[model samples]
Target chain A: QTAATPAPAETWLPTLQVDTPQQGFDLAIVMARRAVKTTQPDVAVLKAQRPHYAGDAARLIDVSGVAAAWFATIAAANGYWRD
Target chain B: QTAATPAPAETWLPTLQVDTPQQGFDLAIVMARRAVKTTQPDVAVLKAQRPHYAGDAARLIDVSGVAAAWFATIAAANGYWRD
Candidate 1:
């Protein structure tokens, strides 16, 4: 007999009610901010261009750092991460 | 002499004004919705479980379809597509 897999909260968190409505909303907001940040480019890496915000170091985002941050936030928020 | 690369609007769209405030807000809302959807699991695939949403098909999102949809939206919104 084959053992069936169980539906853990980790797998279906988007609609699983893993968090309360307020908590979910808050998490969604936090995730949204990260997603927006992911779409930004790194100013230093693309520095050859006409630097629009040349002196503003705060506006850049390193592309390579995004995937790590994205998955980290998701896993951390959902309690799927291990120490 | 090495040719320097230019930062096109496509590269810096996250912080750059690729879209207007209203447009960006709308896009962000749209993107946020998609990101939330990405976190949802497909009901059909995970149907062996208790099926919290057994009768409802509308609540599900196919995982495979997400990447295509995601890139398409980003590319379309940013005018990166050539077709």
Candidate 2:
């Protein structure tokens, strides 16, 4: 019973000229993925790419919120978690 | 019997001075996560970041190779996937 969070696109969207909410979300996700691939070509995560960009977000992922979800598993598996 | 793959640490490790394979792996993963976070702060993946850089790679992920894994899911969800 809550509202969906407004992404950065909502506030400055008119300036950037993004059309819809789904468009903004899509744009953000692609940018994130590209960031990882272009920056680190040797990481294990890259080793598992499915080519079509339809991968899952991991059922076991979620470290309080989305901000930490991306790094939680790797840090714990690497034994770098401190709490 | 099977042999584990040799990470970058094993090759030409004398000059760059990466201590061990584990260290190399850790270094690579960290670099990947940092690249994504720093480059795409507004992205949802960043929102899901756990600060420790240990997030799961996603179960339903795998695009034949690592290159495509990074952008696979969002592309499909965004209706950008073709094959």
Misplaced by over 4 Å in model 2 are A1-16, A42-83, B1-83
Lowest-scoring 10 consecutive residues by lDDT in candidate 1 chain A? A55-64
The alpha-carbon deviation from the true structure for residue B52 of candidate 2, after best TM-score superposition, in angstroms, is 12
Q: Give the TM-score of candidate 2.
A: 0.24
Provide the TM-score of chain B versus the true chain B for each model in turn: 0.28, 0.35
TM-score of each: 0.19, 0.24
Per-residue lDDT of model 1, residues A17-71, tens digit only: 3333234334544554445545755645445542422221211112112222343
Provide the overall lDDT of each model, using Cα atoms, as 2-decimal numbers: 0.35, 0.35
lDDT of 2 by residue, A1-83 (tens): 23676553222111211345444444444433433443444566555444323343442232112223323222322234233
List interface RMSDs for the candidates, in order.
19.8, 16.3
| DockQ for each numbered candidate | 0.02, 0.03
Candidate 1 per-residue lDDT, tens place, B1-83, comes to 23576553232122212344445445434443333333323433333332432243432333223333433333444444333
Docking class of 2: incorrect
Highest TM-score: give the candidate number. 2
